[model samples]
Target: MVNYALGNNVITQIGLLVHDIEKTSRAYADFFGVDKPQWFWTDEAEKAKTEHRGKPTEARAKLAFFNMGSLQLELIEPDRNPSTWRESLDSNGEGFHHIAFVIEGMKEKISLLEAGGMPLLQKGEYTGGRYAYMDTFKDLKLLIELLEKDR
Candidate 1:
């Protein structure tokens, strides 16, 4: 499993990027035989960008959040815009985007990672907790989040 945490907990989440939102999410839902994930549109996440990246910009995203047992999965379908998701889709075809780890002390963790050479791609607070992104591999991405309970 992809490790997004630093000696934290077991792998708890997976993020997938797709060119077609409905098709991919439908496949996963059918495969898992689970209810559809809570959907979030670009407008809802507009404030998320500002909180993390500090800008009044929005990208069209069709996001679905689902659960497999205790593990959470996020499927992303990018809309036409200049966003990290869009950038990733442009560079690489639809596939695994990032592995997210639930952590504590986001700023401290981010500082250490940044000092160690990992760059912070974006961060935002939504739904309850704060999340940060970093490039752990040349191709794949890493996302770190402090859960609501952690904070």
Candidate 2:
């Protein structure tokens, strides 16, 4: 078996880009017979320390999460700012964005992926952890996200 560079390959989350998060989330909740999950904006750039294409950016998005067994579905509505989310939405017209895996060794994992041709596209810190989006679409057919929660 091939050893994965980022450790466990279990996908914990699937993200979708949407134009209207409220409408999309409500539709999903109704379709699944579940209550609409609350949506919130990502932390400000000051707190999140967001970077896109290696430069600091103030880009942010409205996000809502739905728990589906061991995996999560995330809806993202990006603001009119430069970010991986916005770029994908504008280019692809709102659809599946990325699959995420919880990981450790953020720097090492990023380096490995980059060296392997999956260059880092964006990165940012959240409340308890950090996340990086890798440009893996060309090889994997979807962007890959690495999430590392503080231990």
Candidate 3:
């Protein structure tokens, strides 16, 4: 039942696409009794190497993160770019975007997921890690994000 070779099913982050991050972040912070999450713009340094749909893109977004034990809540305010966040917002409006699983052996996992017909939709790296979004909404009913952490 559980294919361990494909990696563990641990969802470390729940990403949400929001129309207004400041309000959402404040709401979540108050609801969870936590301080407001620090926001980061993806375009501070060099543009993140990413792809949307099937073409290379420079899509950007402002992100706010809140840690809940081992799990994290990510609020994404997409900029005027062709990123997945923007696309998801356009198609579904403000709501869940992707569930991320942090695990090892990402190449193998990516291969396994790809073999299952889930094509890679977007990808970008930060710090010493990388993440990839898979187009699995049709079958899985939700987008899946695979994160490989180096720290």
lDDT of 3 by residue, 11-71 (tens): 8899999999999999999999989988888753254577777687778888999999989
For residues 15-97, write the lDDT of model 2, one tens digit per residue: 99999999999999999999999999999999999999999999999999999999999999999989999999999998899
Worst 10 residues of 1 by lDDT: 141-150
Best-performing candidate as measured by TM-score: 2
TM-score, candidate 1, is: 0.77
Clashing residue pairs in all predictions, respectively, total 1, 0, 0
Between candidates 1 and 2, the lDDT winner: 2
Candidate 2 lDDT: 0.94
**Residue 53 displacement (Å), model 2:** 0.5
TM-score for each candidate, following the candidate numbering: 0.77, 0.97, 0.89
TM-score: model 2 vs. ground truth:
0.97
Q: Give the Å shift of residue 10 in candidate 2.
A: 0.8
Q: Would you list the clashing residue pairs of candidate 2?
A: none
